[model samples]
Target: MQMLMYQECIDACFDCMVACNSCYDACLKEDDVKMMADCIRTDRECADICALAIKAMQSNSPFAKQICALCAEICEACGEECQKHSHHDHCRRCAEACFRCAEVCRRMAA
Candidate 1:
């Protein structure tokens, strides 16, 4: 429940959220938006979950660990999806953030 105890996880969540948002915006601007539908959707979902995980941790919610577990799963999925399009700088950055966030969240959940 101590905020300081989860600072790393919180930071990772925030970073992942930002990266996902950026990826989402970039994907929308891609020439073939239709082909990026899955990536866009996953980015949005990943961003939302990261935001929720941050909130849960900051608020000292009893379910913070569970939320982190779910966050890790979503982060991994998002990382995989973004990695598919790693040729794009935005996607590459997002994939990295998602993977980092997943590792941090997994530690928090443990």
Candidate 2:
């Protein structure tokens, strides 16, 4: 059961990474990219953190739980930031993905 939970968490991390990357790329294409600067930065940070959390979990490290907890927080913040621009379809989708990933990470952390 623990192993299965780890796998699910890893999957969620990957999904969040993809979503973050996509959102970042889309943001760069916007006419006013400066407006999304913070969102872009958060997306990159969240993606990196999620990937690190997945690696830690896969290694069965004792710190994995703590890393996952941090990852969940970052993911939630990123999601909220992304949701601010619901006018963009990509941002909306990315926010949803981040929210889902955060929930999964929270469960795994616990």
Candidate 3:
């Protein structure tokens, strides 16, 4: 059960990473790129953190729970930031992905 849960969390993290990367790239292409600078930076950070959390969980590190808790927080913040640009489909999709990943991370942390 524990292994399966960890695998699912890892998968969620990877999915969130992909979504964040795509959203960041799309944001850069927008005409108002400067307005989205913060979003882009946060997306990149969230993706990196998610990846790190997944690696820690996969390795059964003692810090996995703490990492997952932090990941959840980052995911939620990223989601909220992305939601600010809901007019952009990429941002909307990214927000949804972040929310899903946050839920998974929360469960893993619990």
- Taking the tens digit of each residue's C-alpha lDDT, what string does model 1 give over 1-110? 49999999999999999999999999999999998899999999999999999999999999999999999999999999999999999999999999999999999999
Output the lDDT of residue 25, model 2.
97
lDDT of each: 0.97, 0.92, 0.94
Worst 10-residue lDDT window, candidate 2:
1-10
**Residue 50, candidate 3: alpha-carbon lDDT:** 94
TM-score of 2: 0.95
How do all models score by TM-score?
0.98, 0.95, 0.95
How far off is residue 102 in model 2, in Å? 0.9
Identify the runs in model 2 with alpha carbons over 4 angstroms from their true place.
Answer: none
Across residues 17-87, which tens digit of lDDT does each residue of candidate 3 receive? 99999999999999999999988988998999999998898788899999999999999999999999989
Segments in model 3 whose C-alpha atoms lie over 4 Å from true places = none
Screening candidate 2 with a backbone cut-off below 3 angstroms (N, C-alpha, C), the clashing residue pairs are: none
- lDDT winner between candidates 2 and 3: 3
